[model samples]
Target: MAVSESDDEGSDRARGKWRAKKKQRPFWQELPILIVIAAVIAALTVSFVGRPYVIPSESMEPTLHGCSGCTGDRIYVQKLSYYWGDPVPGDVVVFVGPPSWNTRYQSIRSDNAVVRGVQNFFSFFGLVPPDENDLVKRVIATGGQTVQCCDDQGRILVNGKPLDEPYVKSDFAWVSGQQNATYPSGRVFGPVKVPDGNVWVMGDNRNHSADSRAHVSDELQGTVPLDNIRGKAVFKIWPPGRIGPVRAQDPQQN
Candidate 1:
């Protein structure tokens, strides 16, 4: 009788342990569902909403920089900045350009594309992936306006009004673009009017950027169509040392 009773107690103890083990393994069983939900949420976020963008160029200079140059690291771009209004002058912006930038990224990467996507997910949350590449530059002129550089007093002019460009050249170098370039190169413009739905843009580092000031094929030059504007870059939020409001170039300058 004693032996039989002892055997029954051991059996009960084993059953208890089995139940405990099952409870401990709950997350493993539910993991697939959890992953599915997470993936669905991510897809929606990337498709319908803002994804964090990383700057990877010096095209914006004092405004933004990517790892490709001396500017340290990446930043989170608000993809919805243009939903309320068009890009205005002095607004920093990001946009996809010609294959010159994207092709180079493809040539260098060797990792699996899925892994890259996962890394980007972490970047979307501003958590990891300390690197990115999106061009950032300041907008200079909006639609239906005339932009010209070098007033009689060494300032830029927009629609016959002089802009107070404290962030740009007071006597900043007026480096000209290619001889036939449509941008305001070397203070050159026969008063070309920005088209009805385009905005003229120039980098704060006017001499260097290949922005709207750069060539957009043969027919359209000097102005970027409104649809091409990804979003207006508002401020620099990285490096933790330099952060402040991106000031406009005195829109009231007349």
Candidate 2:
């Protein structure tokens, strides 16, 4: 069959129109939709999947650090990990700060509703530092377990078994001569048994950390309810060299 010139001209016009339409669309015109999609994904990730958290203190030193004026490892807490599974001993968890946790509410300003509303919005994506009302610590003992400091050899005993705590930070190296005798505070804690549904949390940097030991006077004896745990710290996301799975003491070892 012979091709018609009109057909060729019609196809050329259609191609020209399509090209013109493509040129008419500006990148900025679609930017809002992209922004919306990004915001939604970030919100969902922070809310129910994983959330980034800045290590706020040296309490988890060697594992995580928030040394004053120093860069700390930023971690992603696996919020979905415990949705169907229970938190076990040795999991590093982020949880709501107890009333006695930190008296200084550094990020909390005047109790203005509008101000709080804005803060909450930014906190959702972890854009700003988390409120002082949040804390991170390692689970020393879960429900029905008894945690005590220092066996005869100066090791933390959980459920009567001495933990192989390679992560516990050493005190001043020069102190010398039976450090446990000199530092009973870190070496000798309670024979306290964890109550059902509660878990005893402590900082890995024992000597420097104010954890369950500091809160023993409270009714709950510093054992946070399992329900209070937000999630487990699963990975280090920042500090490129430090990026890897967060070291968690094996719960099965307990």
Candidate 3:
């Protein structure tokens, strides 16, 4: 059957109007929903999967830098790694500082409620550093193992054997005896045994780090409980040149 010209023209106009209305819907109307979704995903990932941590001090130098007055490496610490297993020797990790360890670093907190709230909001998504009382170091000795300073060649001894410690800082001044006059003193610490459920940690930059050895007088005797550990540091994700896996060295290889 033949359709009337006027009728066909009316149908075409209706289709065009529908298309225009669809295009006219404001994109801003959907923006808030998208932002909420993104925030939820970020929050979940940070809480359960991983998060970025910026090196804040030179304690873990050469392996992970936080040198004073210099930019530090940004790494992703896997929050779920320790869920199924405990932190073993040679695993770089992040953990909450013990009360005894807390005195070493000055707290950086704002008394203003608004400023503190703002920082807390961003921290939920791993956008900023965690609290000042958090620290990162390599696991040197697990429960039941002994950790001591300085073998015959200044290497740390673990479980009655000297560690290879290829990652240790070996700069000219350190090797020449001009440096390392204090901390790594050839026989500075005892052959202390790690207590059950705790792990002894130290920084790769021995001379510069205030680690387990420095906190021996504390109640935990310089060891952190496994429960205090946040997770293992797995990757360096910043500074293109330094991007790579944060190696977990095997004690057996040394």
TM per prediction: 0.65, 0.79, 0.82
Q: What is the C-alpha lDDT of each candidate?
A: 0.60, 0.78, 0.81
Candidate 1 Cα outliers beyond 4 Å, as residue runs: 1-25, 66-73, 98-134, 169-185, 243-254
Question: What TM-score does candidate 2 get on C-alpha atoms?
Answer: 0.79
lDDT of 1 by residue, 161-232 (tens): 777765653234444442332443444453557888777776766666666545543345556667766665
Highest lDDT model number = 3
lDDT of 3 at 200: 93
Q: Which pairs in model 2 have colliding backbones?
A: none
- Residue-level lDDT of model 3, residues 1-254, one tens digit each, is 89999999999999999999987857798889899999999999999998888888888878897777777898899978788889988899999888888876764556798998888888888776666577899998899988875555556688778887777774223242332424445335767899999999988877677788888878888899988888889999988888999998855356
Badly placed stretches (over 4 Å) of model 2 are 1-25, 108-117, 171-186, 251-254
Decoy 3 TM-score against native? 0.82
lDDT of 3 at 239: 84
Count of steric clashes across candidates, in order: 3, 0, 1
